[model samples]
Target: MEKQELFKIGDVAKMFHISVGSLRHYEKFGLLKPEYTDQETGYRYYSTRQFECLNTIRYLRVLDMPLDQIAEFLRNRDVKKIQEMLQQQKKRVVMKQNELQIIEKKIENRLQQLQDTLSSELDTVRIIQTGPRRITWIRNKLRPKSYLDLETSIRQLEKQQENTVVFPGKVGIGITKERLLKKQYETYDIVFLVLDQEDNYNGIVEELPNETSVAIRFCGSHADAPVYYAKLANFILAHKLTITGFSKEITMIDYGITNDITKFVTEIQIPVAAI
Candidate 1:
């Protein structure tokens, strides 16, 4: 009989940079067994042919295949079974890819918004040309009067939807001309998230048309928005602009940048037409 080449467990572990414990685990799970064992010292050795089995195990593990499934597949080594498993994993990878892309877009927008807010002059109204946008929103007949109202309003929006957005920003508030004229600065009739035109939404969504608008970026809480709003109103009057749509109070720095509310950046935009 010819002597077959064999590898000690230590040699196999060092060669693969894998733990000997993992090889032992594979044995316990009936996935692979050592080709030879010395009874006197209870030492294990693997045949050179078993290296292919270990390679297959490592490959399946990297693909996140469950151990039990890997064991079953290895038992049969069926081409059709491997194809089906790979197909299922591919679907999961595709879903994760889409989710990552959405996250990347949000991060990019947040960075741009933070930079714009840092560079902007507070209390100065500016005219800008805006493209079309859409929003998924919560409308409240009674305006929000406190932070509790903001929380409650957001809860209402989430209550009706399959998924809720708590960290999404920039936050939007919509107020009618009547509300502003009545000095209802403490209350906002609607809160919204600006949505991508292609976003999947089944709830109340409003499409804002492309138009010229006046906007003011300022620092403070919602209670202090009237000051910036007044500045916008004055700018509109001085520039011969007419109010054309609801006012939107968007949180440029949606996350708190500092402990003080005065450090928070909020931007207010009102659609307008030249008189």
Candidate 2:
């Protein structure tokens, strides 16, 4: 009988660029077993015969296949099984790619919003024209007097959304036209998430058409909203503008983005038309 060449566990790990513990894990998982083990030293050794199996394991792992699935495939070892697994993994990869793209888009939008808010003239109200916006909203008399109350409302909105992705910098609280006219700034009638035109939504959606709006950006959170809302009201009154729609008060920067209170920026936009 010819002597078969064998590599020690450490040498095999180094060759494969994997940790030695990974080999032990594979053995524990019953995925792969060493070709030989010294009884006295309890050292694991692998021969060239195991190289193909290890290579297959490494390849499947790179495809993000679970160890159990890889083990099943290795045990079955058929062309049809591998083809089906590859198809299933390909679908998973495509799904992940789509999810990652959505995440990337959200990051870009958030960064752009932060830049816009930082450069904006704080506390200065202006009349600006805005295009249509789509929003998913939950109508409730939510007076977020404290941070805890605000979080509770947000969680409620999230629950209503089911699996929809809520993008930051796009959340807003609404005050009805009547409430605004009555100078009711403490109570919010609706909590809404602004959605991109391409966003997949499962809740009630409304499209707000293009209109001129009274807008102001200020350094504040929900607690500081009343002051800014009053400023918008004053601006609208001075400009002889009639409030035409619900207020869109979004906190552009908050604890979610940073903990510094001084850096907080909130914007209030209310659709208005010249009276």
Flag clash pairs in model 1. none
Best by TM-score: 2
Q: Which segments of candidate 2 are over 4 A away from where they belong? A: 1-4, 160-164
C-alpha positional error of residue 180 in candidate 1 after TM-score superposition, expressed in Å: 2.6
Candidate lDDT (C-alpha), each: 0.76, 0.85
Error of 2 at 256 (Å): 1.0
Cα lDDT of model 1 by residue, 145-182, tens digit: 33445776667655655543444344577888776655
Candidate 1 root-mean-square deviation in Å: 4.2
Best by lDDT: 2
For model 2, what is the error of residue 168's alpha carbon versus the real structure, in angstroms, after optimal superposition? 3.5
RMSD of each: 4.2, 2.4
